[model samples]
Target: EQKAVLVTGCSSGIGLRLAVLLAQDAKKRYHVTATMRDLRKKDKLEQAAGDALNKTLSIQRLDVCSDESVAECLNNMKDRRVDVLVNNAGVGQIGPIESLSMQDMQKVFETNFFGAVRMIKAVLPDMKKRKSGHIVTMSSVMGLQGIVFNDVYAASKFAMEGFCESLAVQLLKFNVNVSLIEPGPVNTEFEMKLMEEVGKSQFPGADAETVRYFKEVYLPASHEIFTTLGQSPDTVAKATMQVIGMRLPRLRYQTNALYTPLVALKYADESGSLSVRTFYNLLFNFGPLFHLSMNLIKCITCNCFRRGAVSPS
Candidate 1:
C-alpha cells in the first residue's frame, strides 16, 4: 500500500511544493493529502498538482490552530490512516520584544508551536496503535541557535525542538519516528510577508535609536544574507522527501550546508559565549566582511547546493 502523507500549510511555499512532489512521485510511493487553513487559497496547489489531483493528491481544509478543525479533517480521511504527518503550518514575527505586544507573541506560538502539538495530538494515538508512523515538523535554524531581532520566533521553535526531542525518545519504543527539518533561509512567501509587515510595524516601547538600528542596520544585513544564501522552497521540499524516504530518519536535519557551520558554532564550544559573540560581531562589527564572506561561500558551493537540491537522496 502507498504511504498516506498528510502535509499542512499546503497553500504555498515548502508545503505546496512537498505535497506536489510526493504526489507526483515517479514510483507511486505516496498518496498525499495537501491541507491549508483556507481552501480558497488552494488554486496554486491545484494548478501545480495538475493530473495528480484526486488521484495521488487530495486537498483538504485544516486549521492547525483549531482542535475541532484538526479532528474533523482527520476524521474525514479514509480510516484516518496518516502514515506520515508533516507539520508545516506556521506564522512568523520579527521586531524588538519590548515593542511587541503579548498578543503578538501568543499569535506566533498559536501557529508555530501549539499548532504542531495539536496535529501531533490528533494523530499520535492511531500511529501508536498501528506501531508505525513518521512525524515530520518544519522547524528553523533559529531553533538550534537564536538570531537577533527574531527572539519570539526563535523561542517558539526552540520549544518545538525540545518538545520533539523529548517525544522522539518515547516514540522510539513504539517503532514510530519523529524528525525536524531545520531549514536556514528559504525564499518563500513567509519571508516576504514578514518583511512587509516589519516595514509597517511600530515599536511602541523601543527607543528611537533602537528602532533606527533595527530598521537601518539589521534589516539591510538580513536582506543581504537572505539574498545571498536563501534556498528555494523546492529545495526544502526535496529535503523533506529525502527524510520521508529514510528507513530511520535523523532526529534533526538542517537543509542548508552553508548554515551547518553556523549551527555547529553552538556545539563547538562549551562556554556558549562563542556562538553569542560570533553572531554579535557578524551583525555589528563585521557587516561588510560578513556580506563578502557569504558571497564567496555562495560562489564556492553553489554547484554542490544545486546538486543536493535536485537529487536530495
Candidate 2:
C-alpha cells in the first residue's frame, strides 16, 4: 500500500498546491488526501490536480473547527493509514485590538491554532499506534516577530510554533517527526481573505473612527508589505514536500525570503552585532513613544484643569 499524506485547507493556496504537486509527481510518491473545509471547494482542488493527477488525489471534507468533523474525517480513512498529516487549515484576522472583540481573537485561534491542535489530536493516536508518521505545521514569520494590526493572527501563529517545538521533542520517542514551516507573506487568496475579513469589520459609517483608523494605520502597510514582500505559495509547498521526505527532518524550517535575514538578525543580537535588531528597534519605537507622549499631554491637561483659581492673597 502506498503511503498516504493528508493535507488540510486544500481548497486553495499553499495546501492546494502542495496536494497537487505531491499527487502529480511521476513516482506516484504517495496517495494524496486533499481535505478542505467544504467539499464544494474540492472541485477546485481536483481541478488543480487535473484529470491525470486527480487520480492520485482524493478530496475530503475536513472542518477543523469542529472536533466531530475532524473525527469523522479521520474515521472514514481508517481503512487507509495516514503516514503524514499536514496541519495547514488556518484563518487570518487582522485589525486593531480595540476594534476587534475577544470573540474575534477566539475566532482566529479556532481556525489557526486550536484547529491545528484538534487535527493533531485526531491523527496522533494512529500516528502513535503505528510508531511512524510525520506532522507538519504551517506557521509564519509573524510567529517569530510580531507586527502591527496582526496581533491576533500573530498570536495564533506563535502558539503553533511553540506547540510544534514542544511536540517535536515529545514525538521523537514515538518515531514520529514533527516539523514547522514558517513562511513570510505569500501571494495567495489567503492574503485577500485576510484583507477582506479585516475590511469587513469596519462598521457602516464611512467616516467612523474605526474605519478611519483602519484606513490610516492598517491598510497602507498591509498593502505595501504584502505585495512587496510576498512570494508564490508554491515556494512554501515545495519546501513542505522536501521536509516530509527527509529521513531526519529538522525541527523547524523557514522557507520565506525573510528567513535568512531574520536568522541573521537573531544571531547578530546574540553575537553583539546589533545592526539589524537596532534597525527594527528604531522602526518600532515610535509606537511606544507616541503613546507616552499622549499620556503626558493628558496628565498636563488634567493638572492644569485641577489647579483651582489662584486665590488673590
Candidate 3:
C-alpha cells in the first residue's frame, strides 16, 4: 500500500527533495502531498516532480503559522488520511540577539516552533485514533547544542526538541512514532538567505565590537564551518527516508558524522562549559588550524572508508 505522506515546506530545499524522493520511490511506497505557503511558488516543485506530479505527488497550499490555513489544508485532504507527516517548513535567523528586532525574534518562534506544533496538533488526533503514523521533524544541530550567534533560532529548535521528547513517550502507547532529523549545515539556499541577511542587516543595538566580531570574525568562520561540514539537502532527504524506513526509528537522528563530535562535547562534561568554551575558542581564534582540524575530523570519521551513524543511508 502507498502510505499517504504529507510534507510541509515542499517549495524547496530538504522538503522538495524528500517529497520527490518518496513520490518517485522505486516500489511506489508513498503518495506525497507536497505543500508550501502559496500556490504561486509551486512551479519549481511541479517542474521537478515531472510525471509524478499528479500520479504520486500532489501540491497543496499550507501556511503553518495560521490556524485557518492548517485546518483548511487538512480538510482538503481525502478523509484527511496522512500516514506520515514530515514537518520541514522552517525559517532562519542570524546575527547578534541584542540587535535583533522583537518582531524578528517572534517570527522565528512563530514559524519554527509553533509552526511544527500546529502541524502536529492537526495530525495527532487522526494518527492516535488510528493507532499508527510516523511524525518526522526537520530539526538542527543547534537543537542539540546552542550556537554562538544563533541564540534565538537555537531556542526555537530547543523548544521543538523538548516538545517532541515529551510527546514521543505518550505517542509510543498509541503506536505513533516520533523522530527528529538533526542535520548540520546543508548546502541549501538557507545559507544564501543568511548571507543576504548579513549583507542587508545593520545590527543597530549591538555594540561596535560585537558587530565587528560578527561581520569580520564570525562570518568567515561560519562560512568555513559550513563549507567543511555541510551536507546536501538530498543527503538529508535520504536520511529522512532511511529514518522513515526503520522498524523502530530513534528519537533523534543526527545526519552528519563530522558533526557528531561537536554534539558529543556537550555530553562529555556535566558542567556544560566544555561545549561553550570549545565554541568560543573555535569562533574567536578561528584560522587555518581550524580548517586543518575540520579536515582531520572528516578524515578520522571514516573507519577504513565505511563508517556511519545518524547516517543518510
Candidate 4:
C-alpha cells in the first residue's frame, strides 16, 4: 500500500500549495489527501496540481472545529491509512483587550488549538495501530515570541507548540513524529481574514473612546506588519514537503529571514547579559516601548483593563 499524507485547510494558501507540490513531487512516492472545510472552493487547489501532475491528490471535507465533521472525514478514509497529518486550519485576530471578549478567545482556540487536537484524536488510533506517523502543526514565529496586537492568534500558536512538545514525548515510543512549522508571516488571506475577524469581534459594550482607539491606533499598526512582511505560501509549501520526508525532522521549523538571528537571541537570553538585542526584544515584546503606548491608548479609549485582546474564530 502506498503511504498517504493528510493535510487540512487546503482551500487556500499554504495548505493548498503544500498539497499541490507534494502531489507533483517527481518520485510520486506518496498519495496526498487534501482536505478543506468545503469542496466547492477546491478549483484553485485542483489548478495548482496542474493537468500534467504525476501524483495523486484527492480532496476531502474536514472542518476541524466540528467533532462530527472530523470523525466523519476520518471514517470515510478508513481504507486509506494516513502517514502524515498536517493541521493547518487557523484564524487570526487583533484588537484592544477591553474591546475583546472571552468568547473571542474561546473561538480562536476552538479552531486553532482544540480543532487540531480533535483531528489528532480522530487519526491517532490508526497511527497507533501502525506504530508510525508524522504530525505537523502550522505554528507561527509568534508562537515562540510575543508581538504587538497578535494576542489571540499568537496565543493559539503558543498553545499548539506546548501541546506538540508534550505530544512528541508521549508518541516517541510509537515512533510517531511531531513537528511544528513556525513560519514568520506568509502572504495569504490569513492576514486579511484576521483583520476582518478582529473588526467583527469588537465588543458592543465598549465605550465610544475605546472603539475609536481600535479604529485609529491598534488595527492599522497590526495589519501593516502582516501586509508588508509576509511571504508567498508556495515558499512554505515546498519547505513543508521536505519536513515531512526527513527521517529525523527537527521539532520546530522556522522558515523566515529573521529566524537565524532570533535563534541566536534565544541563546543570548539563556546565557547572561541583557544585551542590546535582548533589551530591544524585551522592549518590543512585553516592556514599555511600542506596545506599551498602544496598550495605554486602548486602556484610555476602550476602557480595556488587560494587555491582550482575543479575537473570535
Q: Whole-model Cα lDDT per candidate?
A: 0.91, 0.75, 0.90, 0.75
List the candidate numbers ranked by TM-score, top first.
3, 1, 2, 4
Worst lDDT 10-window in candidate 1:
302-311
Candidate 2, superposed: residue stretches over 4 Å from native: 52-54, 78-80, 203-214, 263-267, 270-313
Candidate 3: the clashing residue pairs are none
lDDT of 3: 0.90
Cα deviation of 170, candidate 2, in Å: 1.5
Number of backbone-clashing residue pairs for each candidate, in the order shown: 0, 0, 0, 3
Error of 4 at 279 (Å): 9.1
lDDT of 4 by residue, 77-151 (tens): 747578999999988877666667889878989999999999888888888889999999898887876555567
RMSD to the hidden true structure, all candidates: 2.1, 14.2, 1.5, 8.9
In angstroms, give how far residue 301 of model 2 lies from its true place: 48
TM-score of 1: 0.95
TM-score, predicted candidate 2 vs. hidden true structure: 0.81
> Residue-wise lDDT of candidate 2 within 1-313, one digit each (tens)?
5678989999889999899988887777788888988787676776778964547787778889998787777777746578999999888877667777788789889999999999888889888989999998998877876665678998999999888988888899999999888777789998788767766665433346656656764576456555555668887788888887778887777775433453345555665456444434433444345444334434554454323111111
Clash tally for model 3:
0
When sorted by lDDT, best at the front, the candidate numbers are: 1, 3, 2, 4
> In model 3, what is the error at residue 186, expressed in angstroms?
0.4
Q: Can you write out model 1's per-residue Cα lDDT over 1-313, one digit (the tens) per residue?
A: 8999999999999999999999999999999999999999999999999999999999999999999999889988999999999999998888888999999899999999999999999899999999999999999999999998999999999999999999999999999999999998989998889888987888889999889878987888888889988889999999899999889887998888877677777999978999999888888888778788677767766554443222365
Candidate 4: stretches off by over 4 Å: 52-55, 78-80, 198-224, 259-267, 270-313
